[model samples]
Target: MAQIGIYGLGTMGSALALNMAEHGFDVAVTNRESDWIAPFISEAGDLAARLHPYTTLAEFIAALTPPRVILFMIPSGAPMDAMIDEITPLLAPGDTVIDGGNADFHDTRRRTAQLAERDLHFVGMGVSGGESGARHGPSMMLGGSAHSWQQLKPVLTAIAARYEGAPCVAHLGPDGAGHFVKTVHNGIEYVDMQVIAEIYSLLRNGAALAPTEIGALFADWDRGPLKSYLVEITARLLSYTDPETGHPMVDVIKDAAGQKGTGRWTVIEALRMGQSASMIEAAVGARGWSSEKATRQRAETILGGAVGAFDGTPEVLAEAFLAARILAYAQGFRILASASEEYEWSLDPATIARIWRAGCIIRSALLDDIAAAFDQHLPQGQLILAPQIAQTLARCIPSLRQVVCSAMHGGHPVPALSAGLSWYDSMRLGHGSANIIQAQRDMFGHHGFERLGRSGRHHGPWWD
Candidate 1:
């Protein structure tokens, strides 16, 4: 195994460093604080003897067995830039730096080029499954050229979440692609969680069920095809107790949710790429606005409406929620696919789905369906609309349609997922869904729309 150095001996870095050593790699750990990874290494192995801790970048580089490979687990943007500036000066030609942070893709691209001048390889890696997965095995995404990737593949594969004998890891295509995919992963997670939250609210408020009973209902769902990490989380959310009152925490549960910017970046990037990514963006915004209860309540009083009333049995509501959730996934996958293509990223949709199946927040049985769907379509994302997924969507469509209608009729925000699905469902299986682009030109530029029968263009205003 190759000797390696890992910077930032925080929760993820420390655990990952030990795992690397256990996997037979001569792993050197680094942090500004020299003692950071020491305790963790001591607990896991004879780290004071086995793991070398470096206090500075120059010292770390000079000590490295050459063709130096260092894994960075630091904050993105500024701090990363500062550290790289220090290390780039010391690194020998052919050395590699792997970024395992939630960095912006464009930034990754810039960094790759900056390092290339000195023959130093840079890889933007997206490592998922948090602290625990890194210590055990986490799903990993890599992006760079074949030459650069070959150097790190062995180490990454050994420390990744795997199924059968295959590592649940892949080298995404050139420059910044891994982080791009990971950004979309987080966005999908936002929508996935939002949909689950909506389901919980609908069940608790509309169905009037207790938290434990609700947890039981979610647990039942977990046993079926909908089995997933989100479902597991649904149970946890209900089981948590109020620290103050010892009451069922669900009743007094605060509506406010927190985010750490991945979801927001996904939306902004989607807009830059001209893709429709409203559902997840709306979810992020919802979390932000949810924190302001006083504003929400006062606005509701003045506006006279907010939450909708959608009456249905638990099964009926669950089906509706599931349908909408599927649509959200549908849009998310399409956006990711488009981004991959635009970047020339040879992203294996099947591998991506499988990697997502274990460690990430969006891990769901739906991933199995997605993997199969991609295999059936190969090089196509329309599989979500294919016969099998179509059937599943059809089974849940009635409820999903009802939920959207109810939410809309009652002045609630349904956002991108349901909105996209509703729009998709409205267009019958045929070409020309209202000639929207042509209509836009007619409305704004007075560019006459062509008539079906005659070759002449119609110049009359569309509305007036």
Candidate 2:
């Protein structure tokens, strides 16, 4: 019998099955569409020997060894629910079901509890890295019980990407922690991409740099502290010329951006937890604005467009980009910390950093330093407060300020970068301008304000 069963023969599912089979694990595979099973196995070549294809759910369940571990790679909402309902009766008492999709954490939590009533195990696993990563190695965040972890550790570790010889997979916490972290990871990714795009705009429009020049610049940055998967890919993308028109590939592509909702989910959850994710919010907003391409074009025609040039050096732009990137990561970590407290997940920020250090789109050299900072146990779990990060921020903040000012004056939008700077400024201020707003509120709405020396609510003099 196969050791594990993979339900759903989608891109991720097929790749994971092949990955598992190549690692010498016998895998039972099935799909809603029965026709896909034969073609998948046939394409597996020598790996097909270890793969057992089942056309029916009953046969698929029967093919797996008892106390089974079945991973679902389907859509997360009603489809996932339907699959669970169909498989629950077939599963034994100790069987485990893993949801390996970009699921909402709240749904994961609900499913975890629902399955427990039947004495079965449910794991919400966040699988990262794209198709290539899944076929080779991927970073996995598993949220489940100790029992489920024990059952799947060997296979998961075998297929996971390694950083310094350690697998980038972990049993993060119970229920929803894994998916939640992945959501925040995507949120940070949105901001990271946005900031990079803003820098590209500055270079292209303000500095009048060619695509190849910007590509070379990004390639150079990849060898420095800004080195990352996204940067590396972006460098390659910018350098590519379209075969049809012989123009830069990026120049020919439309400006509209598309999203899968994970970034929006992160911002929503952060706000629900009473934490600020302003950079992520800005990134999400920028994407929304980009979608209204016609509206933007009309607005530009009516109000005019950017005419000023950026006079800053590339070194200063790099530093500014680095500063914004750091602040954006700080915001993401703070949200994770807040969610951990609210959900009692006890998530290890160090572990998260370590896992993200490799096999993920956002993987970078900086994560090593972030992991070190968390190892020192940051005060109040604030990543920005860590001495190393704070030192870096100190060096970069001035450059960030210069970039934001120059970009704004040039009539170029740097929403993510500007938001990061604004958040940093707000965070550092010991006193803020909220008192006047509080006085206004008290005068108009009879809302009370607290006096500086007193704990209890006090009326403002504006009421008199």
Give lDDT tens digits, candidate 2, residues 1-464. Answer: 99999998899999999999999999999999999999999999999999999999999999998889999999999999999898898888999999999999999999999999999999999999988788899999999999999999999999998999999999999999999999999999999999999999999999999999999999999999999999999899999999999999999999999999999999999999999999999999999999999998999899997569987789999999889988988999999999999999999989999999888888988999999999996876789899999999999999999999998998889999999999999998889999999988888899899899879998876667
Candidate 1 lDDT, 295-356, residue by residue in tens: 98898789875455656666776777677667777767777777877877777777788787
Best by lDDT: 2
In candidate 1, stretches whose alpha carbon ends up further than 4 angstroms from where it belongs are 35-37, 43-50, 251-253, 304-309, 378-380, 406-417, 426-437, 447-464
Per-candidate TM equals 0.90, 0.98
Q: In candidate 1, residue 330 scores what lDDT? A: 71
Question: Candidate 1 lDDT (Cα, whole model)?
Answer: 0.77
* Residue 362, model 1, lDDT: 73
